[model samples]
Target: MSHHIVEVKDLHYTYPDGTAALGGVGFRITHGESVALIGANGAGKSTLLLHLNGCLIPEAGTVRMGDFPLTKKTLPHVRQTVGMVFQDPDDQLFMPTVYDDVAFGPLNLGLPPDEIEDRVMEALATVGAAHLRNRPPYRLSGGEKRAVAIASVLSMGPSILIMDEPSSNLDPKARRQLIHLLKSFEHTMIIATHDLDMVLDVCGRTMILKGGHIAADGPTEEILQNEPLLHACSLEKPLRLQGCPVCNPVRA
Candidate 1:
């Protein structure tokens, strides 16, 4: 099976404190598609993402990675197919060295030492962190840490990449570099983020979640341009799309 297709059918979930996180969400993402999931806080974006890799089980529905349903029995394979980069780089980078962090996943898979080394190096190279592989992860800058965290996931050889708030806390240059790197990747990507500008640059399709359900899904340009919808969803047009006050001043 290709493992690049992701499908969710009538998924529902709730938190232990009686918060209804996802009422019933469904979506299908085909191979090689870069999709953005955007919503206000408590909209269930994270909840849905957690279900994709079996980190959170559905209370009343199904998640499928390619042809296989995501259950405890298939959790291992699903995790291998779907690589997740958490919101905070610190949450992902726990090993002493960058190389160790990147190698951790492959090591768990019980791959040979040489193969693990190769994967670690290749992943670090892919994220432009090969030069920092010997350094301690905590010593790296925010952008460098982000890169290495991504390298750690890449080493696992996942076909579907799920990233949460990737550009958060990044300076302009680092954010730009991240956009370029994301653009260069061929993996099927699902990014849940508040950065609409990054969404404009990195994703072709956008899905908006509201109150534990999907509110809208369409072309990024179209969805982002809908001021009414964006306002309703507690979002605004990407700064790039908004008219500059200096250029479009109001007249009496």
Candidate 2:
């Protein structure tokens, strides 16, 4: 039997303006599993991500992190357990300085000043953004900003991490750095991204969402290699799978 660390049961959500964002969606993420959330624009990936940490409560259905169900009373602890990274780093990094931004989460937890400092430094180092710590957040490069944003959450020490479009604006080098940094995490990770290559690198499982429902869920390799299924869902084969001289010598 699998030990699920996160569970969403019969989940349903509708935006305030009467847009149905989720319709009876459900899934279980086993402990230490790295899962990919794949879908097209407006497919509700971000909405599902918010539900993971109680950032946006489900209109109907339950979100469970471990033994605890997400509710008003458990939100604080739930947020501590799940740290979210938004699509844009700017949405998360608002402090004037990178050091301050990275320190914010631990500071809010009322951790000792010394511990917060250590965590901040450690997280910066983990993302390879230590040298950029003293600089102002707004002045940093896109990659630097992303690293610091990730560091901010890392400092909080969450065991369940969710990211939305993590590689969206990143250049190749920046994306590589982020992938390496994410690979070092021991957390149960759920990444919502269009970057299929990153999904291949970091996730063992894949879930494809469409029309507010889970359309497919299974082993990552099998799902990703299904070119017809991908095209049906408005996705394409990963670049590596397309016209690879060695692996897929003949493009199907």
Candidate 3:
């Protein structure tokens, strides 16, 4: 009996200009499971991530973090519980310095100064960015900022972490480092990415979103192997699988 830390039901959202972002999308993430959210552009992956932390309220349907509903009254709590790391590290690391960025959440919680300092240092240490605490966000490298952004979320001590395109702008070494860092966390994680290889390495389950709806959801291995499903979503097999005869037996 696994505990579902995050649950979404019949979620629907539309942009102000008339774009239907999420159409009745629903899913549940159990405690400590890493789930990969895969879809093509305009498939509503980012919109759905917004709903997880109550950033975008649905026109219809419901999103719940544990038992707390994502209403106006509970939004702050939901945001705290479901930490979000945006696709661009720059979007999240806007504070003057790394220390302030990481301490922001804890400060909001009104924790004592000593506790905030402890949490900030622990988070930076966790992401191996303690050395950059005094540096401005603009001074850090892309990988360094990514690490700090993650630490900012981690400093809040959230139970679930949801990232949008976390591996988007990293070098090979940085990408590998990010993957290793994510793998070390014990919290439940949902990563929205096109990095099929990262999905294979970091997540056990995969969910495919197509036109604001869930087209497929299952084990990462099985879903990635379904060529038709991948084709429908405008996705391709992982590089490691694309060349492996065992993984891609029917090459045409």
Best by lDDT: 1
Candidate RMSDs in Å, in order, are 1.6, 2.4, 2.4
Give the per-residue lDDT of model 2 (tens digit) for 1-252. Answer: 222399999999999999999998999998899999999888889899989988898888999986679999998888888888988888899888899999999989999999999999999998898999889888988988888888899999988889988888889999998899888888899999999999999999999999899989999999999988898888987887678678657745
Candidate 3 segments exceeding 4 Å error? 1-4, 244-252
Per-model clash counts, in order, read 0, 0, 0
For model 1, how does the per-residue alpha-carbon lDDT over 113-159 read when each residue is reduced to its tens digit?
99999999999999999999899999999999999999999999999
Q: Name the TM-score of candidate 3.
A: 0.95
TM-scores for every candidate against the unseen true structure: 0.97, 0.94, 0.95
Native-referenced Cα lDDT, model 2:
0.89
Order the numbered candidates by TM-score, best leading. Answer: 1, 3, 2
Kindly report which residue pairs in candidate 3 clash with one another.
Answer: none
